[model samples]
Target: MIEDILSINQRPKMDEVEGVLFCLLNMLFYNDQKKTVETEQISIALGKDFVISFQEDAHRDVFDLLRSRLNMSNSKIRQRTADYLLYSMLDLIVDNYFIVMERLGEQIEMVEEEVIRRSNTKSLARINQLRKELIVLKRNLAPVRDLISGIIRSESDLLDDRTTKYFKDVYDHIMQAYDLGENYRDIVTGMQDLYINNVNLKLNEVMKVMAIVTCLLAPATVIGGIFGMNFEVIPYAHHKWGFYFAVGCMLIIPIWMLWVFRRRGWF
Candidate 1:
């Protein structure tokens, strides 16, 4: 049997298959920091008396339970056909979809909460990364789902009568995965909307502050302009206390504006 498969850095070519029944299951491999998902394919070929599986490497898998059962002398799998082993492997793969999606669901909840509370460039970046990863997952998973469905519908001796029920269970899991993808897509959309609304809300606050400050300074600018005029009969410009009066006017106007703003609850 093929064990855990290596990731894309430098993977060895898989051996050619020569068999009547072949199943290729590509799983999503996720990286936390990068929020990346890569496809890790597990190739399984079934024969009348033996099952051959190929993987990237030697990592442990969801098949540990089956392995333990195999260790037991009188386990049901030992009594069953090799096709039963194939079903067991496929069932494990489907069961794993639930595990991966559960982790993703937690991540979605965390991101959703953060988006609602406060958002930053980093948070948005994370959200975008998550969306892309989900897209990749969906793209890789659809073909596997179709392949399983086709197997269930096909009249093939490769799948025995006893394990047909198990394959159907795997089909249910694939359907659940589709539902999860749709739900997460909606959630990602909601996160994007929340992010935009928060940004616009911040901008509106900034504009409001600028508008209030501009209104406070408008009178001072007008007074200063009038006093600095080149005309000969300027009243305040000629007065001994002209400078003091102009300064006083500038200060008082803004103070009054502040009071008005405070009373009107504009600030």
Candidate 2:
């Protein structure tokens, strides 16, 4: 039914009139031949009796509500000019921007929970993935906001004064979405910093404990080295209990060092 209304090939062109032409449909909705919709280079022209709209595709028509309004027997869209239809379509696209932001917010919250509960390497990888996704979204969405802004401020007669007002509403929604994307990006950055700091603190604690253990054993190692030497005149070498005496010294020296450290609050 929509194709029938937009079938320029089948319809006869009336005498050239001067009105704004609005081809406000998704390029992706069309056949596979030209799937990418270049919103920046959207085609618009002035025609004879009515403004002609050449929607490139049929799949992602953001103007469903406008279609429904037009289908109604008593709809203002049917009575109004083509410019009004264009306004309605643009408004729907702007509304969809809010929907996308809502989904993004939920995703960010999930990432926040994961970051807080786990400070592993896997968490850092996940944060990177999220950052990339947000970057792509920001890139795609920024252009859309600019395009809608152009439509609102454009002086083309195709856009009636009242229709431009509707476009302004769409422009505001785009701005809000842009702001949200930026905020999410900042949050991801902060999370990355926090994860790095947490990992570093844990490593420092481990190194400190290792250093203290090595310090506590230094005296025992030195005593063992002295007894292990092959010299024959060592003081405790020839007694019947020489081995026991050496073992006693090794044990006593380490215990005294540990006690001194504890008294000084090193432990």
* List of clashing residue pairs for candidate 1: 2-53, 2-55, 4-56, 4-57, 5-56, 5-57, 6-56
* Count of residue pairs whose backbone atoms collide, per candidate: 7, 7
Which segments of model 2 are wrong by more than 4 Å? Answer: 1-66, 235-267
C-alpha lDDT of all candidate models, in order: 0.76, 0.63
Candidate 1, 2-96: lDDT as tens digits:
33233332221212234457676665555566556655667777787888776665593567888999999999899999878888888887777
Q: In model 1, which regions exceed 4 Å deviation?
A: 1-19, 32-35, 240-245, 255-267
TM-score of decoy 1: 0.83
89-206 per-residue lDDT for model 2 (tens digits):
5566657655555665666687678878878888888778778767655665676676676666667766678767777777787788788889989998998998888788789888
